[model samples]
Target chain A: MRGDVQMRTMESSYSTKEVTKVPGWHGLVAWDLLFNNLTTGLFLFAAVGELALPGLLAPVAKAAYPVALVFLLTDLMLLVLDLGDPLRFHHMLRVFKPSSPMSLGTWSLTAYSLPLTLIVAIEAAQALNLLPAGSIVLEWVRKLAVVVGFLPAFGSLAYKGVLFSTSSQPGWKDARWLGGFVANSALMLGCAEMLAMSVLSGHSKAAASLRTVLMLLLLLNIIPAGLLFAEFHNTLSRLYRERQVYLALVLPFVGGTLIPLILLLVGDSAPGILGAVSLILLGSLAIRSLIIKIPHASREK
Target chain B: MVIRELELAGLPQASDPPIGPLSALLRRLTWPFRRGRAPQPHPATGFYTDTTVCIGCKACEVACKQWNQLAADGLNWSGNSYDNTAELSATSWRHVKFIEQFAANGRPTYPDHADSGAPSREVTLDQLLSGGGADRWLMMSDVCKHCVAAPCQHACPTGAIIYNEFANVYIQRDICNGCSYCIAACPFGVITRSDFDGHSHKCTLCYDRQRDGLVPACAKACPTASIQFGPVDELRDRARKRIEELHARGVPEAYLYGDEPGETYSELHSFYLLIDRPAIYGLPEAPFNPWLHLIGDYMRTIVSGLATVAAILAVLFLQGS
Candidate 1:
């Protein structure tokens, strides 16, 4: 919707200080950022499922990796398609620049795919009964997912936030709470996904447990979210005063999070939990798809 | 290794080393580039724009466009004096800003483009006749700053943006994947992604012309020698002398912008001399590089991730209980 934002001519000389939107970093960039975070959330879910609740949520554990793998691969394809030269996306692998968050992100993204794929392979082999019941390969893959996979999954969660903050864009410059906010939101996103899966599989116990964790996460996420809002309080007040912005950002996020959080806190029924998780999922998607646009949107006038 | 081979009189041996047939074929194919002549080091070069002398004829802009073969922007009435080119873009690298400080009735005004849909230049006969409410009309030809530590270079993921031998920030056209990170990272709003090719582009400081032992096209075509091109050190020295001369001549308001190392950003290699603050010329007063906060950003990420890990562990413990 914001794609038509023009690099408009200076209306007046005095307006130059606050105007001039840099063209590029369009909607596709926002979509990529959102998908990358979602994929990492799935990775975190699978990693935790395998390590902590193998017996209780073993089926959900088995399903999470493949879903994560699919999401990750799709996100990678979207990222390449978002580039100016899709065919030369491999050029990102040419160097290892720690100073550049994008450089580090590209490398970490590639590294993350390996352990995820390995876990998916082990899951596939087990599904086909290609190995014995107590196979060492199965155990090793699960353990590796915890040890090796955690690093990149966490890296994925963090890198996008670092990437945004380490740019000259105005809304992003003061994003001290961005990493925490994204990680916490994605954690809630992960719980919502797992809750849906467990509830569908008729694991009321797992669903209840996931619901409790989601409640805690929902409360925890407020710290970073509130801080992030406060960080932009001075710079973004003018932009936020518009009715469209309030409707687009504030209404959905507040309603999505608060309503579900309240429901989870008081209610324990399957239908209620399912409905709440749905709201959480929608809330995260709504916010993420528009978050990266804030910096550019501020200069639209 | 190549130098040692040449010094030891083993150049032939280095080129045709004893190897398997497959290895030999690979070696032969790569030998030319491996033994290529080393490049000569050159001094860091950039422009020293003294806006006081700018006539706003836009000869440098035309020269830049012609030499770079950049696509022309369609004619659009800017309503901001004679600055019709508007701003720098993927195509228009050199933009001459015409700051019309005076308006009709001598209001000392930069009149807002009113609710009227059409853009208007508000000069009236009264102010012109009375010679009242007159303010300085500042004209500056702005280009890429080519900062000593370029934020765009640091933000490029593909290693496409690199400093050439002259220490000018050069974008490798073939290597850039048009990620557009460089666009957002440039504090001066210099780089822009082209809709035509989907690649971000800015002034190369005429790396091609400099390689051929020629001055940048803009500097060469400048009518008033406003855009001076030379070694950065030489330009700084000249700027200091010019500043002293201006102050002596009672033009005390004149000072250099981007000439000295800034608190938040490095000294701009392509610096400027202006009579007013940088904000008046549409330049940031204190442009900050993202590099300054890069470490803090990463630390926040790691700390957030660690907090997440702890949260996850706590949840797991609660479930077990």
Candidate 2:
């Protein structure tokens, strides 16, 4: 019976001939996800950092909020660039669809942008001494930005995972753990970026703390990633069976995940940590692209 | 050969591209599709493509292209039999996929239909060694399934992909931002992004013609009546009777695909009658809509996401101060 099934499947060439790739969301979507998580990670890091390690993190995070805002704008820009007819971009805001993950994510991005901009504005004003640092009004505004920012942060953070998982793509379907996976990925990438930032500015003490956190994240990220891979094993394993796909993905794993992981584990050198951070960023971006690409791009005719 | 040599030498190979400014302008001027009768309302309709009777004429394919005025998929030979157009795409909306699994000359490279999941009808080596009619050529004039619960509709963040009154899944090109979300959302691989224009395209199920109370170009042009278009309910009934007739005629393998709703994937507005499993035609044995896990996916995110946040906090707390 199994052989018969195989024969029919082989005869049909069903695996090879189906609509191969997603029409357009390939390279740009990857960038969008990266930047999305990058922005989210920075903010989330600061949010947790303020409470967890107030002395070391509070001032730096305050400094990084502007950078996170920039990363977020780029993410939104990439989202616009990914559109088929970008001129018709305004149509996205015409509806408030809860059923569609993409719709919800877009709205979340929009919702989050306002508070994010305000947070940056407040930070910038205080930095430039436009507003008195201890003024009651500015403090209230800052608090408001943080409060208004909460729900949308959680919503935006998980939307991409749901967006990818709740699609008809073979590898993506039924992977309910994807939303959490996105969160984990964001944290991993965020920590890497922070470690890199600390090393660059010669904040060895800050780097030490960030390094430990990043190492822990890299270790634990395996759980959700492992589960996702197990869920996606059937599709991914099949894709990996193809020589071209195997070649395409191996680099991201080795350079992105493996090498950096080793460097972080053993090395305390600033340059080594920076190299690990850069490689992880590249590898992470590549892996995200591949995740989207593996299903959307057709290797076979 | 010269282009390859030049490319290998890292020299600019000046090959005249297929799509250049001159050709594009010429195509625009010579656009030949007739603007059919002014649009009007029609009932919910669909195509019942019976692959058993398809003769691979490709008249439907040509008619579809002519009526739609879609660009030719170029002169490249697929080297995969007469299926030069390949699968349905932004340009080639109606495609005839030719699955030629015939025995080469006299030797059978595949198993005989003995184990085809039906009644016991086994073939022996005696029959196989001899020149037997081991020809199992399948031709499906493929088009959009236009699913009842179209995943593309759910995936379209812009709400550009919608179900018309005819229940045909339609993409409003004007509103579409071409996010390609719908392209990924489709299980059948029907939607595609056009190279000419970045926007994704697929069969509109002849929405314009249907509105004008006319049968779609492909079904109308099918000489063998293999592609039948009519009200979906009536078509479903006809399909049932036809399948029964095929089964009674000793073709027990015949079955309807996407004719009914499954656990996750819903019914297809446009369906097919196949003599073999759907996989034989590059279709999944059981295609699922990712939207089925909509709530579950979000719920899982809450659990996983919160836990990760807590982990981040714990990690920071331990290392900080």
Candidate 3:
């Protein structure tokens, strides 16, 4: 998108001063951004479930699993649909090391998920009362699920950094800086789900707290995103590429960061909360997409 | 006193051997950056790709395949240029890029001079070599820069890739899970995932050869000594002299690629001598790691976090009112 902005857009949203202001984009833009986050979060969550429970809850897990599985699986299919082979995937795991994120993620998935499967198994067992309700195993499994389930949940949330931080690409490698990006993104994404649940359940403080966390994350991503842009520009010191970074990273910071921040600060009503929540979700999606789309060359010498 | 002395006589003390195999293994696994009392500082291994003497021979490509036992590319052309193996791929770790420029000076060689004029001298490579000429051809052999601050290394969650004592980037074959972050992180567009095996592959700087006191296979194979392999300092000195010689002979465009001393890297190990802009040879002029800008992103997150906290507080207050 930033690349396309460079190629297509003629208007100067980016300026050459210490402070360059950008015009606001429309509602559709924000809507599109939120949609992407919702989609990614929901999809990744489902993948976590599949790897966690394969057969124990057969019909329910089977019927419901594909909803998330199909979405998660489709992205890979899309990558291959563009006239590329998909069979080469197995090689990703053949000689796996613990140092690589993909390797770690694969292992993390395996470790976090096996227990999740057990949880489902235990749940099925409980539903069937195959074991007594007061049995030690049943009590232990329930306790374990509450504790262990968060592994895959939180792991899925935080794994984006592992993917981005490892890229030798200019946009992804800022290992020191990306923690907030991932944290805020995950927090907001999680908060949005909680917010939707809140709205459905009645505007409870839990939902409100989630919205508050989401807004905080959205605003939190902005300042450093700006500073990072300045640093990125200073580092690159090239017009052609720096312009692209500014457009993708900084432009969204306004609609995604500032506007939403302003809305939150000025209005504390339900509409205001919804508006801010919606914007942060949107901005996060754009940021994530931009992070992924940019191409960078290797820096290791 | 005599009895005490006898008791301690021959029995080895618990702390007698602190530097045993277990300790040694523990140190190596844990102290990645520490260089304690050791034999010589590890050999500073690196690649020296001297593009000046290159004849555009694809022998390096062939040798890489033979040594790595890579799958054949089956001779397909992209038709856009003379390039057969279009770009770097998962399988092909080494690729020679070909750029065809009609104007040798990289722009309209003679802005006003065109076909409207009478018969122009056929400016060929031989003629340009013979005497002063306006047009010239540029050829560069591209490979991984083997960056000192490799984002790929920093980003590897599993620690699959690491820099050797010699500072050569190494990917442990047993560990790489083929995330392709290295492939994407590489600014030089060098690293690629092998289609056959998914794991990311790139020039090892011939780490294996350097370990055995030999030059990289590509550098060794170059008949013209085009790819000089040696200590980076010595190579830099030689490269400087060669550039000076080219300048003395009036090839003003001759400059070293990836050799800026104070740049992001402390003078690239696999730096090149180029007769064109780095970008013309497909290098980012002022490349940077995105991680550097993360500080700003962190700030933004903090501000955003505060705002979130404040907003929640404000909402709670409003509800109370």
Candidate 4:
């Protein structure tokens, strides 16, 4: 009996070596994040530019509006497809549970999408002479669009980070600063997007102003990005030690921030500006994908 | 005088008569609608899995599948260990994990005799199989923890995962949209989506049996009584007593996992008794609830948004000046 007891104790100490192999929120989920950030970022840039620098940047904002609208629709489709039952997607909206980040997100998307669609429709009508340009009614509609689109745009931008942060996975949960990081990334990407659009459309004055705004956004982004790195180093040192850290964190820092800043300092050529914007976009996607790939390190063993 | 004596003898007693079976059944059927009567709470039921006496018979697994009508997972061997089923899934609610231990020197870790003081014990696998040697085999039956404060419940967007009448976390099949958020939120990694149905599934704790006032099939079929089922409070008491008894008998490494609420989530309704650290059993020692960290994350996001606004304003101001 004593030998039996000892054997049982020893056996309990042996490792089960069971690793959960479920593919969590990959493929379309990552694409959804990219498209979501792009939509929110672009809409925000357009709305703010239209309000602040109407004379200089209004045309650039108008050009970005339809593209942002298309991206938003794509994101919504991707979100539904990722669900196990796409037909039941409306069930998420039946109840409002603040405890659930996904519920908050669904509502945010709805709110953001409505005003955005109105803005795009009005813009399209104006371009086609369907609605008289500079009419007081059209001006009022644009102003209303700005008001309604403000909170939800930022909410949609930040909620993706909230969604990931609320996961039980250690790689995500411990990084409380991820929300700030993602929000800042969105802001940087938005400015870069507007800058690229203005440059490509031959609006040199608007492009120059957007370049300055992009530089300011990048400078501000460093705080949250640095905080994320510090938090990851302190909490998930094992992950910090892995090569994924270089790919996700270091590469993004260099390609997204450093290279873009250098390009802005150099003479404003179309290729240089476009290359810089493309690099930032690539860096953003890389970070999002990396976050998805890194599993919560299984407890100590 | 004769009439008065007859009347006294004819008087019957005033006691109520016994209820008939038909009337009892009628009363039961109508009990819910009876006015002003409060609903009675059912006793909280859960599993008390004691790993000490588990013999790896796999009877509980068989009984669970038979009772739940769960389909077979397949007969393929993993080539990893004696465990053929691998891990718990949507179909396999109950899984038996097998662990075989041997020292680096090819010697059995457990000595044949307790009197032997040396760490090295020479016992071959053949001798161990004969019940005369030092090899040790540990088998634990794993199931859904049924946490008191389930993250899956909080994370579910449609409220599909909820506590049933028996205080067990139940996934409402029809309501489940299969967002798979619960799968990510579950700290134990117990919940899984069925390939055929695309809905999340886990152990229901034999809720139907509990409704009928019967023990779960796995607990009932366990030959060694390793998988004990009863009221949670009673099971907790029994588990404590058993732990003490084991300690007295020289097995001091015994401890409970998910038995009490700690830094992780709330106490688990169905917990375990184990002789090793939780990680050895493939359980997290310190599981974090994502909700716990939400406030800080949200605050940071708000602050970052403000900073972005500040940057934009600064750019505008610099250009204006």
**Candidates sorted by DockQ, best first:** 2, 1, 4, 3
For each candidate in the order shown, give its overall lDDT on alpha carbons.
0.77, 0.76, 0.53, 0.78
Better model by lDDT: candidate 2 vs candidate 4? 4
List fnat, each candidate: 0.45, 0.69, 0.15, 0.51
- Tens-digit per-residue lDDT, A1-301, candidate 3: 1122221222111111111011111233233333323433442323332233322212232232223233334433432232112333333334345444445444554455455556556656766788675689675665455356545534433444544554445434554445444544554554455455455546454444445555555555565455545544533444246576557666677767788778767855677767766776677767655544433211211
Model 4 residue B160 CA deviation in Å: 1.3
Which of 1 and 2 is the better model by DockQ?
Answer: 2
Q: Of models 1 and 4, which has the larger lDDT?
A: 4
Best by lDDT: 4
DockQ of 3: 0.10
Q: Chain B TM-score in candidate 3, rounded to 2 decimals?
A: 0.77
Model 4 lDDT tens row, A1-301? 3345444444333244423434346778878998988998888878877787788778898888788989999999999998887767776776677778888888889999999899889988998999998899897988798778989998888888887777776567667888898888887887888899999899998888888888878778888878877766644456456675566677878987889889887968989989889988887787787676656343333
Order of models, best TM-score first: 1, 4, 2, 3
Residues A29-78, candidate 1: write the lDDT tens digits: 76676678778887787577657777766677667778778878888988
Q: What fraction of the native interface does candidate 3 get right in terms of contacts?
A: 0.15
**Model 3 segments beyond 4 Å from truth?**
A1-188, A198-301, B1-41, B79-81, B104-116, B119-129, B317-321
Measured against the native two-chain assembly using Cα atoms, what DockQ does each of the candidate structures obtain, in the order listed?
A: 0.29, 0.43, 0.10, 0.26
